[model samples]
Target: MEEAAIGDAALFHSEQRLQQAARVNDTATIRELIWGKVNINARNSMNRTALHWAAMAGHERAASLLLDHHALVDAEDKFGMTPVLLAASHGNLSTLQTLAKAGATLTARNRLGQTLLHCAAVQGHPSVIRYVVEDLEGIPVDDPDQNGKTPLLLAAESGHSDVLSLLCELGCDLQAVDKESNSALHLATRRGHAELLSFLTSAICSDAQNQDGLAPLHLASQAGHLSCVRTLLDSQCQINALSSRRQSALHVAVERRQPPIVELLLRANINLHLQDQQGHTALDRAVRSQHAALADMIIKAERFHARSLGANGQTGELDLTLRHVGDLSRVRSVLWALATRHQKPGDWKKLALHWDFSAKHIQALENQWTGSDSYKEHGYRMLLIWLHGISSLGKHPIKELYEGLVEIGSTDLAEKVRRQANAEQEPARRCVLM
Candidate 1:
């Protein structure tokens, strides 16, 4: 028993010595150890043999010495990482080539199911990646790891531009997705890989969405990646693509308070009137998030766009129109009459809902009450709410205001308001305030 215990200690010590020799590329000491008939495959506590140590240290001479001694080239460490995998990870081309030429399995994966290409990609080693991809035929080009992330996907996540360019040049699957169906474009955008995003021009980049229905632009906008957003926008991606929540990139930018991206989306003439899953617009979202600058920017952009389209509203001054609509004098007379007759402050909220003012927009408008009476303020807010709907519809606000008055039993005022648009189009005609 004592002799066996001594022998086990000697073996462990010899393995330790072998690791030390390999780390320094001491080929003479390694050859001496091999001549002593030392177990070449002996592993330390981490299950890593001398060749694993040599591969990790990038010692080509020591690695060659071990290989000449018939070292277990494909032996896995505790993590299932073979020497070739380690070599690729460290950018050791010579040692890696030696292992590959020695029949070291290129497809051998660690516990993570990552191949040499996956490691090379993640580490941003283009040379190693090129050899594994170009030199070695039949390499699993799109084989996924445990997370279903392919080599291209991993490269995109880390913003490895050159590696990605090489992969793209080699005709790799540009549309490769991860476990969540997030495409390479999705990851590149999310990580702000502007150059990489610019590299991908396939239709998948413009259309692929993750599990949440968020496209690459949505991720880029949410992450506040200005250049990435520019690349996506330049790629001619669907600027108004909505997510599962029916929210656009504009919504994401506003929610995240990204002003530059918001400006980009706004300049693209995105549908500001589009409602989200939560009944919010980009303007409303900006207000809800308390991003005062973003809110002002959204309002300013919408007003400018509305004017550029020659979409003048009846509200006169464009600023009075709150996000695509405003309260016309006709609706004002109706609400003004109701508040004057009934003198109820809260009652106007119900009428505001009747006009189809979004509860969110209405709630935003209701935040402030002015004048001596809340009823007057409520009436004013109700007028503004109706104007917003009227403005977005680009209809005759004056005509619509007149119709609302007649519907609410205020025909006397309706007849008077009808002449407001006599010089313009018909009552049913969609016209902005002119």
Candidate 2:
């Protein structure tokens, strides 16, 4: 047993030396080993023969020497990688030709089911890619890896533009879906590969849905790839495109804290009221997630959009903020007076409900309290809510509220607000952000 163990160790050391020689292109050392009758098909622990190492190292002469001694041209290591596959991955064109001529299996795959084309694409080896896909009479360029990723998909996913371009020229199925049902375009957009994604623009319908039921636009937005998002949007992708869960790109953006993307979507007239599976609108999501600024921005955009649609019977380009800043200040002041004078329970609630403070928005504001005089706080919140709506309509919110007060017999507060607006200087600075 000891002698056998010793013998095995010696052979292992000898094989390591041969592999080392092949790795460094030491042909003379390889010749010496072969001359000593060393097994030409000797495999290392990974079952990678010296031929595999020589092919990977681009040692065409060493590979030829091993082939001359009857090395198994199709021998695969533990990774199921044939010598030809390694040669193709290294862009060893001459070695690949030699292996092909020797009847090496061009159709062989690794344990992951990745073929030479897949390997070449991943390595960005255009020459090897050409040789495998063009030279081989029946090459399987569209064969998928274990991940169901084709060579073209791998090239796109790897961002190998040259390899990807060649595959595109070769007419590989651009719309072929992977195991995850992710088309090359989906993978490209998900990876933020704008150039590669652009290359796949020839698909009849770019709205191919993946397993998650998200189109490329949704994935691009969710991934926060601004360029990809713009590209998809320009492709005539539905701005309010929803996922399987009914969450639009706006919802995904807010959930992921992508404020700039949210702004872009908002300007595109995305449906802010479009709720997701949680029954939460984008603004609701923003507030729930503590994105107060984002929530306010959405509120501003929604009101402005509604007013822009002329739903309120308003028209023309009135500057909502410039016209309403003084109005807002006076309304806040009047609310304090009304709360103090009326001293009525549920007045703030009536005002908030009357001015259209969303139940959710008013609830969020009410969560922050200081004593029993919370009506004053709710009324103030209501005034701010009214201000946001007024700004959106591009009208004077304070003036509208002032008129309502006069009709309700709050003539004293109404006159005070009118006097204040007349005393201001256009108030441009106060409403610049609005």
Candidate 3:
């Protein structure tokens, strides 16, 4: 029993040395070990043979020597990574060629069902990828692994622009998706690859959605990838494209608290009125998520966009910034104070009626329910919408506010609001007074 244990220990030592020698490309030491009749196929702690080390390190000559000594080229490591897979993953074209010439199965897949082409694409090796696709028989460029991820998708996920370009040039399917139905564009956007996203958007339809019905724009917006979001918008992707849940990219941005992306989408004339499957607009999402600043921005955007459409009767893109919206920017605080501090519950609906606000407009504003205080938000939103319309026509907001309040029988409140509007306070003082 003791002798057998000694023999096993000696074999482990020799195998460790052989792996070490192969790692450093020490051909002389490897040859000496081979001459001593060391077991070439013996595995170490990770089940990796010496050939695995040689192939991974790109030691072409050492790999050739190991193959000639009848080493197991297809021996899988603990992760099922064979010598050929190791070579391909490390971008060792010469070592891979050596393995291929030694009767190694070039099409052998790792445990994840990833082939040499998939590995090469992930590693950004165009040459190795080309060799695998062009030289290896029956190896399709669009072949999928266990997760249905093709080499093109893998390359896109890893942000390998050159490999992706080559794959596209080789006629790989540009619209191919993985098991989750995520396309290369979706993967690139999720990973925040702006340059790669630009390339992909130019190649494929930017509005292509994943299994979740999320387009690249939706993913970019939710992930807070500002450049990627801009790229998708510039590519003319459907700005108001809804997901499976019927949520637009705007809704996703607001829900995820992506302010910059939200601001960018608003500039593209995205539909602020788009409701999710739960019937919540982007503004509703912002309000529900307690993102007060984001909610305010959406309200401002919605008001201006409506005004622009009503005035022009044209649906072309319009920048909805505060500057483009006009004089309402000056009295935003006065309007806020009127809605939050002065107006009572159900008062906004009466004001809406007085201002000729359509039932649809009133309903849209009241759609969000956040308890009894919901009326405060509803009134605030309605006030902004009314202010936008009045400002767009170049009308005096103070005069309009006084008239609207009198029509609703709030004459006393109207006098106070008008006085506040006419007060010659500094900008800081105005904010404090409101």
Largest lDDT belongs to which candidate? Answer: 3
lDDT of 3 at 83: 94
Q: Put down candidate 1 lDDT per residue, 203-240, tens digits, no spaces.
A: 36566789989998899899999998888888888888
TM-scores for all candidates: the values are 0.66, 0.73, 0.76
In order, candidate lDDTs are 0.77, 0.76, 0.84
Clashing residue pair totals per candidate (backbone < 3 A)? 9, 0, 0
Q: Report the lDDT of model 1 for residue 120.
A: 89
Q: Model 3: residues >4 Å from true position, as ranges? A: 1-8, 307-434
Candidate 2 local lDDT, 353-423, one digit each (tens): 55555676666555545678776665665566567666655566655766666665667766765665444
> Looking at model 2, which ten-residue stretch has the lowest summed lDDT?
315-324
Candidate 2 — which pairs collide?
none
TM-score, prediction 3: 0.76
By TM-score, the candidates rank as: 3, 2, 1
Better of 2 and 3 by TM-score: 3
- Model 1, position 121: C-alpha lDDT score: 92
lDDT of 3: 0.84
Clashes of 1: 9
